[model samples]
Target chain A: MSTTTPPRPRRSRAERYRSALWLLTKRDLRVRYSTSALGYFWSILDPLVMSGIYWFVFVVVLDKGGDIGEKPYIVFLIAALLPWMWFTGTISDSTRAFLREAKLVRSTSIPRTIWVARLVLSKGLEFLASIPVLIIFAVIFGAQANWNLVWTYPLAIILQAILVLGLGLIVAPLVVFFRDLERAVKLILRFLFYASPIVYSTLDIPAAIQPWAALNPLTGIFALYRSGLYPEQLMVFPIVMSAVISVLVLGIGLLVFRRYERAVLKEI
Target chain B: MTEPIISVTDLGIHFRRNKARRRSFKDLFAGSARRSRPGEFWAFRNLSFDVAPGEAIGVVGRNGQGKSTLLKLVAGVILPDEGRVRVNAGVAPLIEITGGFVSDLSVRDNVYLTAGLHGMTKAEVAARFDEIIAFAEIEDFVDTPYKHLSSGMKVRIAFSVIAQLDEPVILVDEVLAVGDKAFREKCYGRIDELLSAGRTLFFVSHNERDLRRFCSRGIYLDKGKLVLDGPIADVLDRYNADYNNPTP
Candidate 1:
C-alpha cells in the first residue's frame, strides 16, 4: 500500500543544535520557577540572604568592620559573593544535569552537550539577574565606581561563564558514570567557598598563601569583580590569569565531553 | 530497484552490567575484588539488514530480545559498538510518547516543546498549533499543567504532535497501547496515512495481530540475534511453530 517518494530537505546540524539548546534552556527556566510562589526571586534570594548573614557575622559579630576596607562590609562581600553563587550553583546542579534527565538523555538523538549548556545558560541568567542587587548595594554604599567598571564587569561575567561551562561540561558527563562524584562535588564546593576570596580580600591573605590562592580560576575572576567595584584596589594579574585559564578550562572540557559522549548512553 | 533508505551492517551494542554494584561504597570498603570488575552484556550483535523506502517492518521478539534497542539504534539515540547503521531519510521516532513532557508546563507548552525536540521548527509548530490541539481534543485543558492531565490526555497530545512531523522515516514502539478505542482507532488511521504517503517504517511490538495488520515484512529476534526474516505470515508461522514444537 506504500509508494516511494522523494525526501524533503532537512536543517543543518548546527541549526538543529542551536534550536534544541534554546528550547531546553527555556524549559529548564520555566519548570524551575513554575511550582514556587517566589519564582524568580529564589534565584537572587540565596545570594542576597547569604550576603546579609555574612555581613552580620563579619562586621557585627567579629568587629572587623574597619579592617574590610573603606567600602561597607555588605558591598565588599557581595561584589565577589554574587558571582560565586552563580558559579557554585551551576557546578552543584550540573552534576545531576544528565542523570536527572535520564529519560530524555536515553531516548533522544539531541546532543548530550545540550544538557551541560542548558545548565550553564540557565544559571548564568540567574547570575545576571542577581547583578543588579550588587549594583544597587554598590550605589547605596557609595562604592568608588569608575570607567573601569564598564570593562571589568562584562569581562568578569564572560570569564566566569566560560569557566563554569567548562567545569560543568566535564562534571555533567563524568557524574553519570561515577555516582559518588555527585556527593563529592558538594564537599568540594564547600571547601572552595572558604578557599576563594569570598569574605576576605586576596591582599589580606598571608603572602605565603596568596600564591596558592591565585591558582584558582575563580580567584582571579572574583578579584576582577572586586576591582570593578573598587578601582583603587584593582589588581591586574588575576584578570589576565582569569582570561587565560578560562580558555584552557573550556578546551579541556570540550575534549573530555566529546570522549565520553558515546559511552554515556549505556551508563545512563 | 532503488537503494534501501536504511541499512544496518554487522551492528553491535553492549552495556555495562555491574555499573550500580561497582558504585557501592560498601563493596569498596569491604575490598571485594570480584565485585569491583564491571561486566559487559551485549544487547545485540552482528545485526544486519536493509529497509527499502515505503517498507513497514514489524520487529517481533520476547522480552529482552533487543527489539527496543534496534529501534533506538535506528533512531540514533544509542550508538552501535561494532558496526554501522546508515539512513538516508530523516526518522521521526514515536518511542515513549509522554516521556519527554515537562510536568509543570501546560499541555500547550509541552506540545511545542516535544514537537521541537522531534525536529519541528517553531514556525511549523505555531502553524499547526490549532490543528494539533483539535486533534488531541483537549481544548479545555490546553492551559492545564501536563502533570495534572490524565494519562490518556497526555498520550493523545503526544501522538497528535508527532503525527504532524514530516520526516520521511517513522519509528513506532507500541505507542498505540494507550487511550480509548476512539483514540487508538485515530492513531491507526494516522499510521495508515503515513504508510500511504510512502514513508518507511519500523514498528516494534509484541502483539502479533497489530504487527500483521500494519506490516508486510517481519524480523523475529530471540536472545539478541535475528532468527528469522521473511514475509510476515512465514515469520509468525515459524515463530509459533518453534513455541509449539520444542526440539528436544
Candidate 2:
C-alpha cells in the first residue's frame, strides 16, 4: 500500500504562534461585538466616562484641579486613564484566561502563554482604539501637547504591555489552582484603581511616601503617558524605575507560568 | 523501521481525590477532570507505548478510566506528572471538538478560529473554507451564528475543519458518533483516507466493530493500569472476558 506521511508546518514556529494569538484575539473582539450592540462603544466609553467622573469629583466638586494636576484637568485625567483601562482590563480578564477557555486551552498545543497574551493584546487593542478619544480631549482642553509623547508614549506603551502580559502569565495559571484568586484579583484591581495615579499624579502624594508611590510601576508608566500633554510630569528616576519594575514583573510572570503550567493543565 | 511518530515513557498522571466532579466550570467537562483530597490517586502510572508512523492503535477502557487523559497527554494538552510523551509531528485532535468553538460567532468565524487554534494558517482555512462547509453540509448556514446551528451541525462543522488539517497525527476520542448514518459513513471514509495516506491514528472507542475496523493494535486499560497490550482481537477478547461481555 502506498501512503503519504503528514506534511510539517510550512511556516516557522514563531509565525504559526503569532497567527494563532491574533486569531484568538480577533475571536474575542468579534464575540464581544456580536453579543452586545454597544461593544466598541463600551470599550471607548469606559475610559471617557471614568475621566469625566474623576474630573468632576476632583476638579469640579473639590476645586483642586490647579493644585493637583495640569490645567484642562480632563486631559490630565484621560491621558493616564486610557492606559489604566488596558492594565486593569487585561488583569481582570487574565484571571479567567484558562477557566474561560478550558477546553480550548486543553485542545491546542500552542504555548499556553498565548492564552493569556491574547487577553493582554485584546485589552491593549481596546486601549489603542480609545487613544483617539484621548487626543480629542487633549485638543478640547487646550492641553499643551508637547513633543515628549513621541518618545514617552511609545516607551510607556511598551513598558505597560510587558507589565500587563507578565502579570497575565502569572495570574492565568495561578487562578486555575486557586479559584479564590479569581475573586481576589478583582478585589485587588478595585483597590489598585484608587492606589494608582488615575485621580491624582504621583507627585501630588505626600513627600514622605513619594518614594514608595513611585515604586508602583504605574507611576512611572503613567508619567510617561502624561508627558504627551504635561511634559513636566516626566521624570528620569521614575521612568527608569518603572522600566526596571515592569521587566521584573514579566520575569516573575514567566517563571510562575512555566512552573505552574503543567499543574494548571492537570487542574483544568 | 520508520521512526515512531509518538513515544510515551514511564507515563503517569495523578488527581486529587477531593476535587470531585462538582468543583467548578472546568469540572463540568472533565467528567473525571483532575481531582484531589488531602490524599491523591494516580489516574495512570508506569504505562508506556509508541507508534510507528501510520500505525493504528485503539485505546480501550471503561469510561472514567483515563482513556481521554491518555489522548490528552499525547496531544500535548496536559503534562504528565511522572513521565513524558514526545511527538515528532503535529496533531489534529478530536478530543471534544465541539467544545473549542465560540457559540456567539458565525460559522465562518468559528471555522477560522478553531482551525487557527490547531495551528492552521489563514490561507489554509480560507482555502478549505468552502470545502469544509460543503463537507459539513452547512453551506446555507455559514454566515449564521454558531449557537443557532443544531447540535448535529455544530459537530459536523467542527469535525470538518479538523479533518482538513494537514497534521500527520490524528487523535480520535469517539467523536465519530456525530451526525446521522450518512454523515458517519462520510466520516468513516475520511478517516480511512487519512489512514491510507499514512497518517498515524490513536483512536479511543468502546464499539468493537469500530475499533476492529480502524486499529490493528490495542491497549486495554483498567483501573489506571495497562491490563494488556496485544492484537486488537485478543485485547477485545480480554477486555470482554474481564468485563463479562459476550466475546465476538
Candidate 3:
C-alpha cells in the first residue's frame, strides 16, 4: 500500500538461508523446552530410553549378537539408534512442517524454503544433542576410541541429515495434495524399521538379496555408524555410498519441492 | 522527488476449481472417460493502484470481498495469478498478528525470532528488546511460553515486535480489532507515530472509524476491482452511498 521503496536490495540466497535456519532453530529450541519442566533433559533422555527398549529386545530376548569385537550390544544399538532417531524424527516432523505453519505460510512473505530448512535444522540439532549420550554409552562399555571413528561419525551424521531433508522436501509438499501421504509415510517408516539394518546387520539378509539391501539409504548409513563405533569392522564403501545417495536425493528433492512450492501453499 | 514506492498495474488473480469425476482404480487401467467442470473463477480482475512514500491508504469492503486477497498479493504471501506487484520499499505486513510467533516459545524469544525473519540482526533486536517488551506490556511474561498467554497477550506481544521493525512501508490487516480498546488506541497511536515519521502505511479494516482516523486516502475494492480512490472523506462517503444504494 505504501509506495516508498524498501531500504535495501533483495536479500541474497545465503542471507535468506542463514536467517531462515537461525529463526527455525531458535523457534524449535524455545518451543520444545518452554512448556516442559525437564527441558534439555528430554533431548538426551529420548534416545537413551529408546535404546534401552531396543537393548531389551535385541540383546535380551533375541540374544543375536553381543559386543561386536568388544563393543557392547547396548553401545552398538545406541550408536545406530542416535542416527536412526534423527532420520525418523526429521521425516515425521518435516512432513508436517509446511502444513502445520500454514498461518505463517499464508500471512508473512518469508520464502517457503525456510519452512523445510528450519524443520531439518532443528531435527539436526536434536541429533547433535544426542551425540554426548552416545559417547557416554561408548565410554561405559569400553568401546575402542579410534581416529577413524571421529572422522566417520560426522560424515554419517551429515549424510543422515541430507537424506532426511531431501526426503522431507519431496514428501512434505506431496502431503498438501494427497492427504493420505501422511498416513502412508508413517506406515512406510514402520515397515522400513525392520527392512533397514537397525535391529540387525545387512549380513543377516540372504547373500542373494544383499544388493537390494544396499539400495536402502539407511543400510549404508547404519553400516557406516557401526564401523565408526567399532573401527575393526569394514564399512567404508557403504558410508561413501550413503553420502553420495544422500546428496543426490537432497538435490532432486529440492528441485521437486521448489517446483511445487507455489501450489503447495495455495492448496494448504 | 522520489519515485512511487509501490507500483501495481493490471493486477489480477483467479482461483480455479476442478470438478472432474475422479477415475476409479479399475477405470484408470481401463481408460474410462471423464468430464471436466467449469473453468477458472476470477477473484479480482484488472486492478491497478500506486502508493507514494509516506502515504497512508485504507482498503475497505465487506466479507468475501477481495480485500484480503489484495493484501496477500501485496505482501507477497501469495502470488498474483495474472499480473505483478512491484514493491520498491521493504514491507512489514501485520496480516495475522501472531503469524511468526511460535506459541511454544517465550515472548522474548519470539521477538528475536520474528525480528530475525524480518532480516534484523540479533544485536539490533537485543537493543530494542526492552522497548518492545515495554510497548507490549508483558514484562512479567517475557520469559514464559507464549502458548500459555491469552489471545490478547499474544497479539500485544506480536504487535510490539512488529512495531520495532524499521521498514519504510507497513501493511496492516484487520487484526487490530482483536486487542482491548486501550490497546487498540495504543496501536493507532503507534501508526500515527509511523506516519508522522514519513513512513507509508496501507491499512485494511472494516471499521469506518479506523479508516477515517488513520488514513489520508481510501480505496474501495469490490470483488477485487478498485471502485473508488481519492481523499478519505469523499471516498468513504461514496463507499457508504454505494453500500446504502445498490445497483440492480
Candidate 4:
C-alpha cells in the first residue's frame, strides 16, 4: 500500500517567532550549564569575579576616587561592566554562532534570523542574571536608589540589545564567508573595551574628544545604566542619542543580514 | 496527480576560482611571466524539475555531480546563482540530523531545540515529548547531556525529532545510512508512515535497495544534468545497465 502525505502549509510569522525564541533560549540555558558542577552559578559568578578584579584595580591600586557628583567608582564600574559584558559576550559569541551551526544551516530551511536572535537573547538572559549582584553592589556601596533608575536600566538594556543584535546580524553572516572575522571580532572587542567608557569615565576624555565619545552608541547605554543606578547624576542628551543610534544600527543590520541570508547557507 | 509542489527553472550555480599562476621571487623580478589558466567551475547549470505533492522522488548521481547542491537549493537552504526554486509548502531538509543541538544540553533539551529549529512550538513539542522519547527509546538518557550520548544515540534523538515535525515536504540525504540495522529499520518504518500520510519526500541515496523500496519516481543526475527521469524501476534498470557497461 502506498503511504502518502499531503503538503502542509508553512508556519505563520507569529508561530515561527514563538517557536524559534523558545527553542533557542532553552538550548542556550541548558547547554551552557550542562555537564558542569557550577551550572547556573557560573552565569552569576563570571561577572562578579571580573567586577571584583576591576574594582580592586581601579579602587585600591589606582586609588582613584571621583564622586562624578553622587555615585562611587565601584558602583559605576559594576553598572558599566554589566551591560558591557552583555555587549562583548553577545558580539564575540555571535561571530561564530552561524558557523558553529553550519550543520543546521546546511540542513534545515529555518530562518537564519532565528539563530542570530537566539544568541542575542540568550546573552541578554545571562545579562539579566547578573542584576541581583548589581543591586547588592549598589546597596553595599551606599548608592542612592530611585524609581527613575528602574526605567533607565531596562531602557539601557533594550538599547544595548538592539545595538548588539544589529552588530550580530552583520557579523554572523560575514564570519561565514571570511572565517578570519571570528578572530577579528576578538581583537575588535579588546579595542572596544578601552574605547568604550567601561573602566574609565567618558568625562575623563579631553573636551576636544568628548563629542566623538558621545557619538559611540555604547557610551549612551553605559551612561543610562549608570543613571539607572544613580538617577541624580544622569546625562540626558547622549542617552537619547544612543537610543536613536541603537535603533538605526539594528534596522540596518537586519537589512544586511536578510539580504545575504541565502548566500550564507551556500557559502558554509 | 496534483500540481507540482516544488518547481525549479533554469537554475545555475557558479564558483569563482583565482587562477593567477604562483610566481616565485625570480619570476617577480622577471617581467616575462605567462598568465595562469582561468579558474571557474559550475556546480549546476540550467537545471529544472517539478515535483508533485505526496510524490516520493529519488536523486541519484556520482560524487561532486551537484546532487546535494540541487537538494540544498530545493530545500531553500541556499539560493541559485541563476533561475529559481518555488515551493508551495514547508520544506524540511534532513541533510544533518543534529542541526542546532548543543552537546552541553540534555537529550530532552536537544529534542526541543531540534523541534524548534524545524519551527515547532514549545507546547507542540511538549505534547509530542513522550511520543518522541518513546520512539527514540532513550528514556533513560533523556536528562543526560547530548555530548555524553553515543553517536548512535545522537542520531536516534535527532531522527525522532525530525520524524515528528509534520512538515509538508521532507528531504532525506543519506542520513539513514548511519544507524544500526534495528535503528535503520525503525527509521524506514517512520519514513513509510510519513509516505502513507501523503507527505512529499525527496531522498538522495546510493543504496539501490532503499531507492527501489521507497521511491516511486527517480531522476538520474550526471555532471549536474538530468540524464534520466522515469518510473523508479525503469530508472534503476537503466542505472544498473550503465554501471555494468560504462561508456568510454
The candidate that achieves the highest lDDT relative to the unseen native structure: 2
In candidate 1, which residue ranges exceed 4 Å CA deviation?
A: A1-9, A232-234, B24-38, B245-248
- Please, what are the lDDT tens digits per residue for candidate 3 over residues A144-190? 76777776667777788789889988888777766667888899988
Put the candidates in DockQ order, highest first: 2, 4, 1, 3
Shift of residue A72 alpha carbon in model 2, Å: 2.0
Best by TM-score: 2
True contacts kept of 1: 0.49
Q: Is candidate 1 or candidate 4 better by DockQ?
A: 4
Model 1, residue pairs in steric clash: none
Please write out the lDDT profile of model 1 over residues B1-248, one tens digit for every residue. Answer: 78999999998877777666545445324552222244767778899999999999999877777898899989998888779999887888888777788888999889899888877888888878887888889999989989998989988998887777768889999888889999999888888888888888899987788888889999988877889989998888888787753222
Q: Give the TM-score of candidate 2.
A: 0.93
The C-alpha local distance difference test score for the whole of candidate 3 amounts to 0.77
Binned by DockQ into CAPRI classes (incorrect, acceptable, medium, high), candidate 3 is acceptable
Backbone clashes counted, model 2 = 7
Per-residue error (Å), model 3, residue B67: 1.0
Which residue segments of model 3 deviate by more than 4 Å?
Answer: A1-13, A66-71, A231-237, B16-40, B139-141, B144-150, B227-242, B245-248
For candidate 3 chain A, the 10 contiguous residues with the lowest summed lDDT are A1-10
- TM-score of candidate 2's chain B against its reference? 0.90
How far does residue B77 in candidate 2 sit from its true spot (Å)?
Answer: 1.3
Ranking by TM-score: 2, 1, 4, 3
Candidate 2 lDDT over A199-231, as tens digits, reads: 888878898987888888998999999987887
- Global lDDT of each candidate: 0.83, 0.86, 0.77, 0.78
Q: Pick the candidate with the highest DockQ.
A: 2
